[model samples]
Target: MTQQLLLDILPGALPTLETFVAGVNHAAVDAVRTLTPGHALYLWGGQGSGRSHLLRARAQDPDGHYLDARTPAHWLQSLATDEDRVLTLVAVDDVGELSDAAQAALFALFNRWRAAASTPDAFALLTAGDRAPLTMPLREDLRTRLGWDLVYRIEQLSDDDRAQALHDRALQRGLKLPDDVLHWILTHYDRDMGRLTTLIDTLDQYSLAQHRPVTLPLLKALLTRQHPDPASHHADAGRTSP
Candidate 1:
């Protein structure tokens, strides 16, 4: 059976848990799936590893709040001590890039959460960084604390995984994306799963407009529109930026 593409998600790529391609991160996904109150999970990985996606998905909970390096310091501090706040689930991303004040706020928040683990306001905190906890450059206390609970490094998708994802997406859309066409796209264009999947979306649209089946020639034509001009036209049809 063909794997399903995530392109058909409601509201379009909203980063829900269901839309996440587990790949080799099944254990991490399951950990987040069953994350309990007062517990914490820290995820570290290089770019394109879907750390941000998971954090955004977890923050969809009614009581959950998502924080990142871009989040304001005051808000971070506020959440740390807001007595009115009840329940659990705080998802923090890009922890390594947090501002000085934000780092302090998060430090306090961690202490409070851990101290209240047995209390009514006990909560769960999920964090992500570009590297493993101890190696992350941050305030010493916070850096050490990140390793106190669960930690997992997210792995990037393999080529087979990417192919399967795109193949699945085509099936879900009820479109015909030939295996050769898939291989061509993988070889010629950007390999990032997001962009590759986006091309699939574009191909579907072009196919609909032209009233034709998906084929190598049609794929080349679509990329031609993307990469106009004689100079780039011949050197690798899909060399245009994704």
Candidate 2:
């Protein structure tokens, strides 16, 4: 099998709430599901904890707008004053990364949303970050504003939970992933759900190409071929200037 068939980039389709392995995050999931106009939710968690996934899902709702820290101030200001806008969701992801001007715009937009909260059953704002509102090192006023709203910490999936999620994903694609194989991958490979899920599709393609079952050896072979010796770079770097 040609190892040239690596696919660690394209992680397939966007994640949905259904695809999310809730684990101990039922409260967080429930918050997003029950989110309505006049309400704001702040979710915080480490990377790979499915924070961005949920935000992206909600942002796909009707009239939903997804923003990140890199979003420009002008765009946010526009949203704030878009008179005809009937927003169902305003999902601001990675709040910690927002620029100063963007933060100010967000503050204004938040106040606008709050000012109209008396009849706020038509729009919702969602923000996410790496730390809880009380701990995030952001503008004090912005942090305080976010703190006033509903906050939830998204829990990272445990190893067993991750395996089950991967198995279910593989099953959705009509591929049977053995428990042992899943466990081994968890231990020996990148645990990012996105990459693991993409690996499923990649393995499916490679299996058909090589006409082999999705066994431990096949996985090992694929992974080995895809990821060569990591220490090679260090060895090459050691040959630096004298």
Candidate 3:
């Protein structure tokens, strides 16, 4: 799908590193600047740490080329030609998930691109769950070289940061959520920012479906129905039993 369509389906606002309210704010902008000069960067962080978000923002640049490692080897091999030179900003998400042969191929591509006489007008950004690529069950050389460039540890968001993020997201979606409802969702629902944003979208849809305003009662009912507690339902059923 085109990037615009993807954005429409997932309309969560893009988080800016410059004024990012959460996570390791320091490392994000630094990573961007380092990559702008055509250096390979390894960003390490767990899920919900904003690593993928930052990578997506960087890939939005016209010269960027986002190559999902899950893609077929033939696709990547096709990108090796000089015609793809304009694909300067390369993002490889889930590098650890690549196959052994694909890993080797990626390493070779890096070596070839790095050794070019000119900079080749390209930069690479790699993301993985492991801090060092060596821990990802790859060859010794590829693992070692993955850490040759800058590596940043993306920190998780603090509680306050997360609360603000929810509010900001609601505002971006043109939903005027009350502070109490935002807090209730943050306190009761999952802590992952990505999931929280999705819940907000779901609630938005639910509100539209029911033709009702977004209120705490409505949110609670929706959440309870979507994520029903079996024990509580059984208890209520027993109480009403003849």
Candidate 4:
């Protein structure tokens, strides 16, 4: 299957994981490395925090099996067999959304997977929006079992990290962004990397459509169009002037 198809089928793009900067937090990286075979590792963080990105990167292994725990049955079905040699890695995103029955199924799967001495070289990684599985409306058993594994709360990017992330994304898209435009985006929009990446994409489209470079004027125009407040635009325009 094409990379695009794989991405569409998978919860998130795994290739992007290599590009994810874990920053100075060796704890997250160390936890990921210690993921033992037949055990589940829980990675939790707020939205736009790149949890799925890390999980997808781990899924790139040829023997990886990615199941969307949002659909509980698929998660169970993927883990049902004892054929560990077939699948070396399993990643589930939005695992907190699994229903009670699904949680029970997961608990059983984890126990079975953990009990098998010859359980191949397979590892399971789960991502959630909360710090602990207990915070989610999960079964007590699943919550208790999930707590047994290492859990890391991924941190949001710092201001410098966010700026660097924007620069990297713009470079990847083959766009030369001016410092002013970058500053304008960082100042006005949400500081989240995901949103900034999207803003860059939209700016790219706007620039292409107008046959204009991504200058302050074009960016201001786009932002104004999206949120039309003439007074605010005029004030911003004045502030940006030399």
Top candidate by lDDT: 1
For candidate 1, the TM-score is: 0.79
The sequence of per-residue lDDT tens digits that candidate 2 reaches over residues 1-242 is 22222444233566678867788999899999888888899999997788877887788776788877656678887777775767777888888888888888889888878877767434788889999897777789899888768999998899888888888888887887887788777876665565567678888777778898899898877766654644331100010010
Which digits, one per residue and each the tens of the lDDT, describe model 4 over residues 1-242? Answer: 00011111112222344466666545775666556566667887776576766666666666665455445464565465455446555666666777666666667667665666254544564444446667866767777766677777888777788888788888988899999988877666664444455567777777898899899888777665543333331100000000
For model 3 the local lDDT of residue 160 reads: 85
Higher-TM-score candidate of 2 and 3: 2
Off by over 4 Å in 1: 1-11, 187-199, 209-242
> How does each model score on TM-score?
0.79, 0.81, 0.72, 0.69
TM-score of candidate 3 on Cα atoms, chains taken together: 0.72
Query: Which regions in candidate 3 have their CA more than 4 angstroms from the true location?
Result: 1-21, 81-85, 172-180, 187-190, 205-209, 220-242
Model 3 worst lDDT window (10 residues)? 233-242
Q: What clash pairs does model 3 have?
A: none
- Write model 3 residue lDDT over 116-144, tens digit each, in one string: 42565555644444455667667788777
lDDT of each: 0.76, 0.75, 0.60, 0.60
Error of 2 at 111 (Å): 0.8
